[model samples]
Target: MSCTETGAALHVEGLCWGPRPGLTLVDDIGFSIEAGSRLAILGPNGAGRTSLLRCLYRAVQPNAGRIAIDGVDLWSVSAREAAKTIAVVLQEMPGDFPFSVRDVVMMGRIPRREGLSGWSELDRERVAHALSHLDLAHLAGRQFATLSGGEKQRVLIARALAQEPRIIILDEPTNHLDIRHQLEILDLLRTLKLTIVSTLHDINLAAEFATDVAIITEGRLTAFGSPDAVLSPRELSAAFGVTATVHGAAASGGTRFSFSLPRQGSLS
Candidate 1:
């Protein structure tokens, strides 16, 4: 795998979204991430982390705001054009598809297909590369539904990689994997040159994998910066209503964290 693709910069300003009037799932939010940066979104459940991601990937339209990719308005482009630039790996795995892993990965090339032509040589090459990149070459012949949970996740990621997008957005990419697979997946993601935006539940993992972090709560962005700067005990405690403690420096690659309920009468 080669890390040669230069990722695009992402910018969001005054973003808001909701299903109905007076109900906002993603409040006014603003942030910017440089090219090739990995951004981890963290917050308590229903804090709108996923909602914010949906807005960024154009899964759902924001009520108002601007989303720019490399200074180009994201909304100004067509869905097909956006698909060519942005790939998404959702948390929910698809239902048992009666297709082989290779077939599934080939679907990623749909956005790049020209007119009604068949799959081109470039599509096959990309699929093969994605399979090898994710270490799924041997499993390419296997039925996708028969694979284990971790394998399924890898296949989904490989599909995303086949899309050859400048930016990849994931909703809990490590959801079904065990500790080892989680670490492996995150390590692989760190090596990719693409811009990564993911919603992660593990604060420590986020600290380890993200080049930058954005903490969202109550549908608003409360903190955004390097893990060392934003993952402070104060911010964690305030955002999660827990006692947070940082145990190691990020530079050491051993930045551990511990969290516990606040003491009695602490909530006011």
Candidate 2:
């Protein structure tokens, strides 16, 4: 509920990923996130945002490049150790398991254990804290499959918190939530004392929540910097193939934007 100590920094260099031999989905994209800073990855469909994120969390193998946390190579560590440092809340829902909400959240503690005997006192305390923080205490006993989309998203976030990670990676964490829930979730993420890297669909939400923004188009990074610097109309137009207008800055609040189709039918 209160602000915690700052988290680790993230560095990505020359990252590339692809399924086939010659076709790259994420092409030499690179960026860095300072400790406790929040970064929003923005791009149109097929822009490799998800692919780039997947490499960070080890969802897929990258053909080239490096990911480091606090100057340590991420892939060099064991998977369990990596889980301790980074937790992820992805877009897809878990399969319908007959687990209770508490059971689902307790899974996050698995990587913290040294042996598979039983839950430690620290694990219980973390689960309780995460549930209370995310407002899932009342629903702790409910079946996981019965919750609404917003509730489900919160539950997943609670699970991620239970991991006690230094960095949190989310892929479209606000997907399927109503406007109110979207704002609430983003607000919560922004306050956490952990490094945040998320892919966001709503440009306005990115403007509101991100300390830094990365714009990718056609598998390449076009921009990376403070939201105000990277989200200019020219960058937006180039990345999205649309004419864009900017109203204000996200850092000082009241930032607004509008978009329209380009009259020229081609980008020059």
Instruction: TM-score for candidate 1, please give it.
Output: 0.96
TM-score of 2: 0.94
Collision pairs in model 2: none
Candidate models: Cα lDDT each: 0.92, 0.89
lDDT of 2 by residue, 1-268 (tens): 1113467889999999999998999999888889999999999999999988889988787999999998988888888888888899999987686999999899999998878689999899999999998889999999999998888888999999999888889999998889999999998887688899999999989988999999989899999999889888889988888998888655678888899898875568
The TM-scores of all predictions, comma-separated, are 0.96, 0.94
1-268 in candidate 1: lDDT tens per residue? 1123678899999999999999999999999999999999999999999999999999998899999999888899999889988999999998679999999999999998999999999999999999999899999999999998888888988998999999999999999789998998898898789999999999999988999999999999999999989999899999999999888777877778899999988755
lDDT of 2: 0.89
Best by lDDT: 1
Cα error, candidate 2, residue 256 (Å): 0.5
